[model samples]
Target: MAQNLDDNYKIAYDNKAGFGKSPALVLIDFADAYFDPGCVLYAGVDDALASALRIREVAHDKGIPVILTEVTYQPGGRNGGRFFEKAKPLSCFVKGQKTAGFAEGLVPRDDEIIVSKQYPSAFFGTSLASTLTAMGIDNVVLTGLTTSGCVRASCVDSMSHGFITTVVRDACGDRHPAPHEANLFDMNAKYADVVSEAEIIAFFRSLKGEAHG
Candidate 1:
């Protein structure tokens, strides 16, 4: 008999890239576009954002660096390139649109960093990787909207850039459960260690006194 999917993948993809000594929490593209019911890009991902907020609180208390990402484009999406042309829904992110703003209660602190991009990966054409490396962050804990899009893209780039990447499953959302679950499974198997919010919170609490907010 053929092994189950999980059992079959366990043979080769079960290895874990555990948390490292230095870490940062990167919140990717949690914009109003995904939360606003009237918007075409609305994903009904409020629960995911709620879970991320909980993680953010603990991360701040633990003094772990928190980074936020946003997608933006100039008038008519002139800067979005082929991605904009391919996905008409990206028009919601045109500069100055309220839908493009960070979701409710997801504001960036004065000391936090915010990256703006026109592509899927937060690291693509952005200073995220360099900034994290400069600050000596060895592990990355990710939380964001659309697991199959920007979140997955950033996860791959995070590992490619040599960080111990971790994806908080409960804190990332997608338009549908199929892609969400599929991407999480693949990411856990090949790129990042897909974990839960509780696990991440426990890990953060364990790092007490290691850094300062």
Candidate 2:
């Protein structure tokens, strides 16, 4: 009999980081560029956004910190560096463009923190690591657009930064199912635990229960 893929990788990549004492929700680059139909970067991930919003509501009620990320480039993409030059669609994120704005229904509350960057990983060249450290956040629940890109980048960096990272499967989307599923499998194997949005919500509720217990 042939060995299944999951069984093949199970022995080596089945390790789970689980949840840490403190978890923060990080929504990466849920920008209008990915939501706007006319935009070159659009991925048509509306269901993903809806799921993330539901997760956000539960996280907010549980007093967990919510962090949002956005990408912006200067005129002519000067500050975007090699990444901007390489990814032409990134022009949608140039400063002051409507496509650079957060998609509708993702309004950040006064208490929520927004981290803007010109790169893929939310942690790269940003104060995100320091901010998480300062807040004593030990785990991260990640969601957003483009599972194969920013989400994967952020997942690896989140683990590298010493946080227990969890990627919400239903709350992330990609240009196609191929990369989306592939990246999720890879992240689950090596970087983070890929779980469902319901699992995350239940975890948050469990925290609430612990607090009130």
Q: Estimate each model's TM-score.
A: 0.97, 0.96
Candidate 1 per-residue lDDT, tens place, 1-213, comes to: 336876889987879989988889999999999989999998999999999999999988889999999999999999999999999999999999999999999988997899999999999999999999999999999999789999999999999999999999999999999999999999999999999999999999998595644
1-213: candidate 2 lDDT, tens digit per residue: 237877888978889889877899999999999888999888999999999999999888888899999999998999999999899999999999999999999998998999999889999999999999998899989999789999999999999999999999999999899999999999999999999988999999888432211
**Most TM-score-accurate candidate:** 1
Q: What TM-score number comes out for model 1?
A: 0.97
Worst 10 residues of 2 by lDDT: 204-213
In candidate 2, stretches whose alpha carbon ends up further than 4 angstroms from where it belongs are 1-3, 209-213
Model 1 segments more than 4 A misplaced: 1-3, 210-213
Best by lDDT: 1
Residue 142 shift from truth in candidate 1, angstroms: 0.6
